[model samples]
Target chain A: MIFIKILSILVMLFYALGSAGVFWGIPAERYKILVLGKFFTWTGFALHTLLIISIILLNGADDLSRGYFMQLLAWCILLAYFIGWRLLKSGFLSLTASPLALLLFILALKVDKVQIEMPGTLKELFIALHIGPMYTSLGLLTLAFGAALLFLHMDRKIKSKTRLTEFDRGLPALGTYDRINHLAVVFGFPLYTLGIAAGFIWAPLTWGREGGILGSWDPKEIFSVFVWFLYASTFYLRILRGWRGRKAALLILFIFGISAFSLLGVNLFMPTHHSFGSLATFTA
Target chain B: MNKHICLVGLNHRTAGVEIREAFALADAGLLENGLLPVGAHLKKDLPIKEALVLSTCNRVEILLAGREEKLEELAIRSWAAARNRQPEELAPFVYVHNDAEAVKHLFAVASSLDSMVLGEPQILGQIKDAYKDALRAGSTRFILNALLHRAFFVAKRVRSETGVASSAVSVSYAAVELAKRIFGDMPSCKAMLIGAGEMAELAATHLMNAGIKSILVANRTHERALELASRYHGLAVPFADLFAQLPEVDIVISSTGAPEAVIRAKDMAGVMRRRRNRPMFFIDIAVPRDVDPDVNTLDNIYLYDIDDLKEVVEENLTQRREEAVKALAIVEEETLNFCKWLESTELQPTIVDLIRRSEAIVREEWTRTSKRLRLSEKDTRALELMLGAIVKKINHDPINFLKNRFEEEKDGQYAGLLRLVFNLDKKELCPRRTREHGSEEAPPPLGPPDGGMIPPRRTPEPAAAFFNRIKEGSK
Candidate 1:
């Protein structure tokens, strides 16, 4: 466990350096820096996988526990970034997406190893249903944020009549970024809806027959619904109202910010039904 | 000693366009004819070994591989005589580069770092074209072959590793980029040319190349508009209908050379209403500004004047200059790599001689021994074949080691030591000592020299040390 913990920290440090390299590489248009960033990113990812596997083998089924859930979410975000990067071939998005993953890793590292006791009546299948799509939605939303950032950057350059920077030239056309944002929301929204629905269905059995849709008014539940609404509105404005480019990008950015806050902040500070009294305690 | 790489030429920097134009070779035929006199001079009296002529509109550079420093004057005289001019006419406008500076110049030229419009991409293609011409003239050999191929690689590295060629530096290109920003890609959008002026025509051509849906040309003179439209295979609309058709066009490039603004804000109001506020990109490249500047204030209307585009170009140029610093580093690195390969070639003759001498001794001993033993014909043939393979195997590693070590050492000092140990005749391998003796007369320029591997003596030592020292100082 100590070795795993040390490896996790090493992975985080590698990700930080990699994120910095990619951030500076795009603007400078240096292949060496970009390659270095990729090297560190891959090494970090491999080390992170080793940590996750070790934790899973040592503490069986604890992979789905709240203690390791943030780490899983960070891994999912990196997976999503890799898929998008390969499919879209947008080098500029990597500059943003890599840093976002690093930030997630840093947040995950700080997350106290709190083991939340599973409800007695809750089935193992119900936990799987809740954790899988939940992380997928978070990962997809993270990618949307990266695409939105690049779209805004390119929009700023074009609107200002400024010369395109080395980074800007490497960016996908505004159309591609807009499409990525829209598609991520379209795909992630359904998965999120299913996850929330499963959580609602599973609540009655665990918390009692009276535990329903409005059972708890926790910050996590409220903000989850709030993020869903924002994402739904983005689709509504884009498909029906014909909002695109800057407006669409800005809305997706808002959705990502709130979702990120809900994922990290609400879990840390706010009280909720999702308790972790069995694990490590908070420091400060 | 290898022939020094030399570049003697005039560019937009050193000469007027007319002088460059006069010296520019338009095609392979012109290059061949241009090199005919220079090639003959090399064969007759000049000490030049290999030659390549790179002649573009912006520059006409004569790159020569030769022994004498005085080949520039001989080349210039031949070039002048070909064009029915005098040597003095071009002397003031021309500049000369020799040895490492010449190599650097070639690299810079091929990479477009030294171009009038910094980072312009056409220069690389132009350089490749010159290389092809040299191939056709049979004037390019190993030295030029190595230098030019390395030049292409360096150019490619510079382009990929820097942002030198990324931005639009012309008004026409800016217009295309503006259209792309407004309408995703220009090919899906329709464009209108409001005037037949050169700038407007240039923009139309650029838009056509970008694959615009359709181009509509509208001018005050109907026939002129028709003629200009026909050239691009576009539709020619009447000048009166320019306002009525504005709803269909996504981009408007206007440069009428009119004294006053032709299209005002009031005219655009009706056009915008008809178009349902779809974005309209206006590029006013005229001096007096054909389109009203006030129109830019309207919704979905983006207007850029000639001044705005010039500002963009200037900014792009500045960015290219910054990128050029990195590009120069790549060029210098590649130049050093080439110099090393060239220095390694100095050991080629010595290596060849070592093999030849060993084979001769074996052959002579075998002939004397075989006669005394009265060996059968089949046995003698087999013995000779076995001995030949053994000789090749024995010599392979030493030759490979010498080649690899010389690349790292960069000077032929080690190879020279090997030559002395092998007792190889230095004169037979390289005639560098002859040029060092300073006989003060030109060597006979005929069919070919007796020693094929000996190159012209320009630099006695590899320039890799000098250049590496300079790089360290800069750092």
Candidate 2:
């Protein structure tokens, strides 16, 4: 447990340093600092991977703690960032990924651990299918949100005909941001559907047919379905209608907002089966 | 003796373009298959060992290596004579640097520090071409070959270690930079030339060289548009259909001679819808602005008139000036290093004399002793091996001292001291040959009648090559 704590702190330090490097590098226009930032991010990623493996080894595969889930979410976000960085050949994503990863890791340290209980081995398989794709898709959605925000900012700067700031100069072309948004939705929507299908299948078996297909009219399940519909419509509009640029970027931002509410607010504030523990215990 | 490296020239700062053109050696056909005219003329009257002539539109310089006393005078006379002018007429505009200064000047010139535009890259290629001409004419020998190679190395060092040439200093280049920021990938973007003006044509050339996919030319005069389009292998569109073609190009350069705005916000709104809101860049370079200022308010359109481009160019030029300061420091550091190597070459003749004297003494003693002993062939071989080892061992400390002490003392003082201590100046064991035959094999000297007892004199290699061999052997 102490070793896990130490490793988590080291991961946090590296991520914080990487964020600082990106913030300083872009404005200064020094390429070496940017490369150093990338090196730090990769180092933090390696240590974070080790931390996750150790947590799994100590607590078993069924340890579905809220803190562990946050760590995994941060890891998946970085994974999505690395993939986008390689595919698009852009370093601007680090401006978002590094600081966000550090924030999530710090949040993971503050949140209480709450392990979920499972009755059968088949349910464990279903949980993996549900959690894995769901968090990965959420990670990609987070990146899409960042790309959309940058696109709008750059779009406004160009339209305003103002002198570009150093941060604006460091941004990739507006088309590059649109491409990232396109890639995220194209891949994230399908994986999100798979995760929803797995959850729907697991619900009836776990609740003993008392609550029907969805297991109950819980806020978590209702909001999840709503978020899925929003994503599906975004994907459809992007592909069939040839929607691009400002409209596509705006829609992606809206979908990401509702998805964030479903993932966090529905589980915490509302009455839902996905709540980690009792409200009294969570607040304490 | 140290070879005197000298440079005499007139550049844009020292002479006007009329004088520079009159003194240009390229017009004299120096690049043809013959000795350089100035070099051939100097060889007839002076002791010039090596010469190279560099002639460009901005400057004409002659780099020579010979005796220091009259080398500059002789080089100026020959240079002026080749151009059918008197030496006195061109002397006032000329500047001369000998030895260390000459090396520094050449390095700075090759690094583009001395260019008209501070960090322009064309000067290095011009110097390289001049060096190649000298090599073809067989006018450059030992000293010049090393100096030119070192100058090239210094130029590369300055370029890579500094940001001197990393920014755009011209209006066309600034436009290209802005376009890159908008489109990211230039090869996928198309460009439209709205006029056949020189500025627009220059921007079109830069865009094509940047690998823009295709170009469309539109002008008020169809014949002029056709002529310009044929040069770039692009299509010529009629001026009436300019709005229809505006949506197809990602970049538009407008310099039409119009009193009013050529592209308006209302027309661009329909074009933006047709382009699906893809980004479009407009570069307006006309006295009366060609692009409407209101068009810049549209969502995906970026417009820059001539004043904006001039502002970008000014910012970049200021950055280049800062970078050039760093580059000049590198040139200074490397100049000092090359001068140290030049100083080390003066020690070569002393080292050669020391070795030859030691070998001569060893051979003289061995011949007299062997004749009285009447030794067999195997014994003779053994004695010869022992004597050769003795000569090498005896000369080792003195040679080491001379090589190491030259770096600490003033030039050639340690060499002179060693010559005095070793009694190397008492007799001239070997007669000095003219520098032109300095590398040829020396004739056999008078030794014992046995003939093979004394070894043949070693052929002299250039000092730089000889020092490199010694360094490699030590390593």
Q: Give candidate 2 regions above 4 Å deviation.
A: A1-6, A28-33, A53-69, A87-91, A109-113, A117-129, A142-174, A200-284, B1-3, B29-47, B66-70, B344-404, B415-475
B1-475: candidate 1 lDDT, tens digit per residue:
3456788888999888788777665553434664444442234434666788888888888888765577787778767776767889989998898888889899999999989888899999988988887887767666787789988988999999887887788978877876776667667788889887877888888989889898899988999999988998889999988788999998899978789988888988888767655568899988888988887766557789989888887888788889889999998988887876687667767677779878888889987888799788898889989989978987798798888886676555555445545655433333556445443433232123422335432222222333355569899
At residue A82, give the lDDT of candidate 1.
84
Minimal lDDT window, size 10, model 2 chain A = A275-284
Candidate 2 clashing pairs? none
lDDT of each: 0.74, 0.78
Candidate 1: chain B TM-score equals 0.72
**Residue B211 of candidate 2: its Cα lDDT?**
96
lDDT of 2 by residue, A59-160 (tens): 787654667777888898899888877865666778788987887788677664665544354865765678778888887887888788788888777655
TM-score: model 1 vs. ground truth: 0.78
Candidate number achieving the greatest DockQ relative to the actual structure? 2
